[model samples]
Target chain A: MSGKSRRDFLKSTALIGAGVTGLTTTAKAGPQNILSEDRMGVLVDTTVCVGCRNCEWACKDAHNLPAGNLEDYEDRKVLDTKRRPGTDALTVVNEYSHGKNSSLPIDVKVQCMHCDHPACVSACIVGAFTKHENGTVTWDTDMCIGCRYCMAACPFQVPAFEYDKALNPMIMKCDFCFDRTKEGKLPACVEICPVEALTYGKRSDLIKIARDRIKRNPDKYVDHILGETEVGGTSWMYLASKDFAELEFPKLGKNPAPGVSESIQHGIFAYFVPPISLYALLGGIMWITKRRKELDEEVK
Target chain B: MKKFLALILVLVFTIGINAQQSPGKDHSKLNLSCKTCHSCDVPTKSDPCLVICPREKITTVYQKPEQTPELITINQLSDRYGPVYFSHKIHAQMSIMSGGCENCHHHNTSGPILKCNSCHETSRKREDVSIPDLKGAYHRQCMDCHREWSHETGCNSCHTLKKDLKDTKNESLQKKYSGKDHPVIIEPTKLVYETKSDKGKLVTFYHDDHTKKFGLNCTSCHKQESCTKCHDVNNTDKSKNQKVVTKKTFEDQHSNCISCHSKTENCSKCHGEKTLEPFDHGKKTGWALNKHHINLSCAKCHGSKLPYNKLDNKCLSCHKGWNAENFKHSITGLQLDEMHSELSCEDCHTDGNFGIKPSCDGCHDDYSFPKQKPGKLVK
Candidate 1:
């Protein structure tokens, strides 16, 4: 190869390496990963929810989705079939029959749990997902490559992919109304709930409130608080009359979801030792083969 | 000067002690246990260490339905909806058959009835979340019974949306409920029950006999009744043509009757082959009730005790105050003349047996009861 072309190629490679290192340094310094002590959270009291589905409509409207009239949500017949959050709708409320009283069904709103140690943030290949200090785990659409690694990693299976769209499909999930809350306004679902079953406040204060409710109404609610320690805790917690497993919540351990995979991946890539050693071994093999062939040619 | 200073200090100490001892309110007459309000053993005036809103332990202030406000406009938390026009008087009256004032005003103390907001904060994002916010409290109190009977959880049942207030219907509703009282409940005279008993299929209940003859209060048997017992909106149309028989446990079916009826009594007393007639005094006890006795409650003749005591057939048994002086002969439809006015009642009523006809054989042989004129036949 000519020396000039080789020099140009070497310059380009150095510039790319510098750019990658700069991006990694900035990501490490960003405040998005910090878990603030005063981060806000929401407490859902399932005992008080009336299965109105108003939260479902409010969530769609806030997210600029195709939400129909508010009166349409009053139709409880939709609750006959269970549903999960989709790309079109960011949240949904499902109904479960109360164990004691059949007339009063328990309604649970399903959405992104916004976990403290989010698997989506860890699994995103492009560094698109961010766990903000405000307890909101949001995804940036610009950096997404339609990998759908987040969908597989999520313990709650919250994030949905827009499979219908041929171009620029985005990952959708509840953003905890970060835009509205930034303006000192309440989340749409919490605002629209007629029963005030969803209470929003500091995460620390919310835990105290949830404990107080369970203490006050011992007979009305089960003692366990869902999402308190499940998957290393979540921004949204729940108080239910029956066990959360009965409400179709996935049973998970207290450890963070990405703990095992991240430990192995980070261990191999630490200080770039494994990749450097692999390249050195391959280079040594090629040199030995070339030297042997040269010696054979000389002997011939 | 030193002595005076010592005296002043003693007086100050005594006053301070007295202030600490009395909380200024008369808790002694409240009839409440100390632990109900106070978390600590010794609560002082400065630091009562009171439990937070001892709702179950507090004494509720009960006012008559008429004394309560007729209309209460709830606009404190109105945002998307207009103010709710609540008919407080009607609800208060309807509460009589259920749980009374304590049902809604569960946390009221022994004073003027406390408003719901006194304990329940108005803001949903308040610091203290031990109790529900005012909006939640109000909705829960209303929806508990309303949903039970009406099966409606729609907000439109109580609230009118701000955009839908263009018509005069809201005003008309406000006018309709203003100063309105719940209509008086009409009681049933008789109710017949078809029982599953093999001995007797028909069980007759004399409703009028219990209220008028036995003088049982409405609350005596209707304790803790749900509003759906009578005001079930879903069953209204169906119940009009057919009787709605609810399935109940055996204990529930006989609880009200067993409160008064003896457990050992024969089942045929209430249940028979056919519907039984109303109780007749003469047929049951052979003492036909007269005009005066018929109007009197059974409690007045027989003491207020259940399983009333029986009295012999003598006027003196009940009327111990009766005598010739106070007992006017004119009350018997016969006013004695001047000659017989001074005589004793025994002259006419032998052995105080006024149930029998008067005979003159005690006085003159020729003077029979009707043959001779006693008092010119006053009647």
Candidate 2:
């Protein structure tokens, strides 16, 4: 290659790199290609919940899923076990015994947190998961490879896969009653929560309302808010009477599960520097080998 | 002179002897006392100074606190033999109406009011004689009348009984101090709700004003009878049942509460007036909260906060029930408990509400977002 042409190429590459750096910097919290405007979400109030499993039942009904315990349903034996929402169930209410009359018993509802910076969204090779403008993590089933990467990526342990379906299988999780939310209605779980344990409203408004409730009844709830810091803040927020950890919510590291992996991948593959350096070193080795081969041939 | 000196020395010696023996005795008496006092020192003679005066003698009774016998309760006795708490106040109240404690008191023929131990000794020769040692005496006297007064022989017969013994000791002491003492507390008779009324017509109970606001004693309405007398559902007709079913009676009793409370009258109280539409419980007086709270089960959230509907449903209010740590997430895990699973989203996101948004910048001082690639702009 000509030296003038090579210099021009290097100059163009530097310009391209600078442009990429500027664009990437602007993308954080800025107007970008948001997948959809309507983001699905949920609101949980620890104070009002009875742990009756009515919302869990409603989710099952809406999804046409089977009951948790059909045999001893009337006896309510299933409640004896603490469970997360599985492939069959999208919502599960677990009972937390605060103490033996030392404190009040707290019941927590578990479901997909539907994070703003979804680990599942970043983990997907097929780009099935994407963030919507309204703060929902939506799935594009057409592009899903059923690799189960989304399952491992979710900080909430949501998204159960249909192992029973051999062909064209799908991942199941609370879609935040997306269909219902789009119609300007609260999710079925929110509608069915008898005690106003679950409320529905705009994400911004709901946060304010929850704050007001906590301010008014400071003695009734713990100070920590669940999901606010989880996976870069999930759209679904929760107020727990007990600490979030007591309810089994994970205390994630400063870097969200996906952010850590993304950083590692970026650090290695961000630019062509590492690979180009390796190629140069390999070419040098080959030249030495060629020199030795020529010297051996001349001696022969 | 010799005779006078000898007489004087003898007199001084006698006086010295008298002074040493009985310092406080009259000297005139001592002059007469040598022969008088020496006469007792002789065989078979009682000394006048050491004479036993029957009038100055005294006898004291030793009583145990348990056996002190002021108006002991069956519970006080029950602590010894599993509690069968009989209301002494109630028994005494009834006995007072029947003239006095004399109705139950077994008086000795000599006219001194016989002590309970006088009849009910440690052990009885026969059932008739077994009036009850101090324990049985109190229990029998109180329980016999209580049985006839209330007539329910269950645990409610006595063990559940309560009494005001505050003034019992003073009243008993006053009786001993003067004959003009009364054990009875005179109260003006007010119209009380009698669960055992002859008519099955649900008693018009003014429980809200009396019990809810005034904090009247539960026994005021329940009275001596079990709550079952009015509430028993199985016994629809008060007269015709072979055996009185107080449990069934309560079912009928609840109807009375429902009548005044309009919400309990129909399903619409909870399900909405227009069956097709939702119930606006939030707007109603009977309904303190909305369907969400009601569906979650009021008892669960307000389990311990019951009857008082103004309970705070804040996470901290209930979280203290689990553990108390100001501004820390240490109960179970990172997630909210099941009870708080349905809380509002804004609760955590905002700056004010104990929201979970800890500034990542607070800990990750060196953290930064990666820059964008060329042409991969957000806008």
Candidate 3:
């Protein structure tokens, strides 16, 4: 075959292969949003957090990250204090003391709640952030340009940035492990928690569970579901001994975080429309170029 | 120069012929010219490069070197399609085990076919759109092979997605081979040398124990990342040999330690803080702190680390400069040595301030301590 014919044949074969494969795709029925609408979240019961830092260790282990200095709990006296969730610390349990009268100080485990209307998703200009159907607001650091807007937008101050990485800085937060979720597993924190302070389940199911726990022991927990209404809902909920405010949880606005920014993003970039239009425009331009080339050839 | 040029031309022709052939060709038979392309005579090397490099080393690869994959432009897609853990060795063995290779052989008359990417390429675009470009190529090959194995063998046949998948099942296999003892020591990584001897009273520092039992939060000494809080240059008083600021005479380390330990849920473990240090009752370390213990909680006094077993039972132990000898009981007009030695001082002298009158008659003779004789008063 002539070289041109050979090339064309290969191209055609490739296209045919694509068409064939496209036809064979196991067409999954339903809303096609198996991942969407499945809102995933974390229910952190601070009252149950023994402050063992098992979740921290488990998290590092899951990510294959370096072991923190508190690898051994013996002679490990740091838990005597309160701490904030930091770069390495996606979640931290801070001990808030309300004197001796208020039933011994409880350690509040703080991490990204993976909100229903994630502010991080809106703040991410490059679309590095996404809220999975299971309600996990995860980030792709590879796409991240290291802007800390998500940190600011988050009412709970969830997303933290790695300031140490000068060249390829990234925003670190609890992903709820979207990768693990796709494979049908619980988040690392939930999986490793010996004491079920961090429980992973379907968001709706978890809400009911939280309500049941509160109803069963009326005096033990406050009546409200923390993530049920906080900051347009978070996948990771909280069941506390006292008022949520006493645990230093922020009183968030009613509207979901992504409302304003997502609309703007859709308005300006128009979701799938812009990309689709761009593809069409490119096809048109290519056709015009080929036509013009043919015309020039005819003239010659 | 002309001979060299002719040689170059022949080399170019050979290279062009080789390039036209599909990838995964027998490398030994191939003869090529590097100069034909590098010499800048040819416009470009139209043939694409095989993406054989490990994913860790190279973040992305072009489907066609000239035409960059559009999906790669969507940075999230690269993250979505993280590297597949393909064990080439295992797959090769599996292929051989499955009736000497015709089962998976491609290219018409192949005996044994290897290299998965040979058939699987970006050409196989799926409808999901989400599984477009290179991802579809990977998924079809991997998932199809895995699905086939699942039917033929067991679930782990190809879907050995987890590292521990095989070992977990092997437990049952081990039971089947009962009575045959094959002791196996699966060493993960060998240590080159012994850094520390296993001699002496080695403290079994259960790093995993405290963390496992108490959880990461049970640790009271370290920061969130587990770095020892006291030793982290920033927290400790460097001048004091990095000793915890709260720690003074070991007693202080004991006392304040409880106050600190009381924060976490597991309080009784450390708050009832006991140390293994030997204590001598003789060398009275004296009650450590000042007048603070009088009004303070007993936890503060007994809780803090003092010199082990040191006691100060006498008045002078805590109350220095006060004359325990010459200080008379002015309330009852009694001398210190006369009436207060055998009698408990608290019986008369209730308050520590020494202002309250502690006279026997004050309680017994309700009217007056000094009896005004009734006869003299009547006159």
Among these predictions, the greatest TM-score belongs to: 1
- Model 3 docking tier (incorrect/acceptable/medium/high): incorrect
DockQ (CA atoms), all models: 0.21, 0.00, 0.01
Tens digit of lDDT per residue, candidate 1, span B1-379?
9999999999999999989755567874675557666899998778989777745654345668887777888989998888888888898888888888898888665644667887889877677666678988888888777877776677788888998876676588778987778988888888877777777878888889999888999899887878876787665453132232546676778879988886777988887888899999999899898776898898898888877788887888888998878877776667778877777889877888977877777778788776675675555
Model 2: how large is the Cα RMSD against the reference? 43.4
Interface RMSD of 3: 20.7
Residue B354 of model 1, lDDT score = 78
Clashes of each: 0, 69, 39
Please give the range of 10 consecutive residues that has the lowest summed lDDT in model 1 chain B: B237-246
Encode model 3's per-residue lDDT on B1-379: one tens digit a residue: 9999999999999999878754334532444333212344432347343334343433122112122211111112233122223333333333332322333333322112233443333332222221123433343344334422231212233233343444444355334433332233232121111112222211122233333322323324331211122213234343331212221354443442444344343433322222222222223253343333434443333444432233435554454665544554342333344433555545544543343444554245564323431112110
Residue B303 lDDT, candidate 3, scale 0-100: 42
Query: What would the per-residue lDDT of candidate 2 be over residues A4-75, giving only the tens digit for each residue?
Result: 797799899999999898889787638544433334345677755655566776777767787563212323
Error of 1 at A93 (Å): 2.9
lDDT of 1 at B79: 89
Relative to the unseen true structure, what is the C-alpha lDDT of residue B188 in candidate 3, on a scale of 0 to 100? 18
Per-model TM-score on C-alpha atoms: 0.69, 0.38, 0.36
lDDT of 1 by residue, A84-141 (tens): 9999889998988875654567889999999999999999999999998889999899
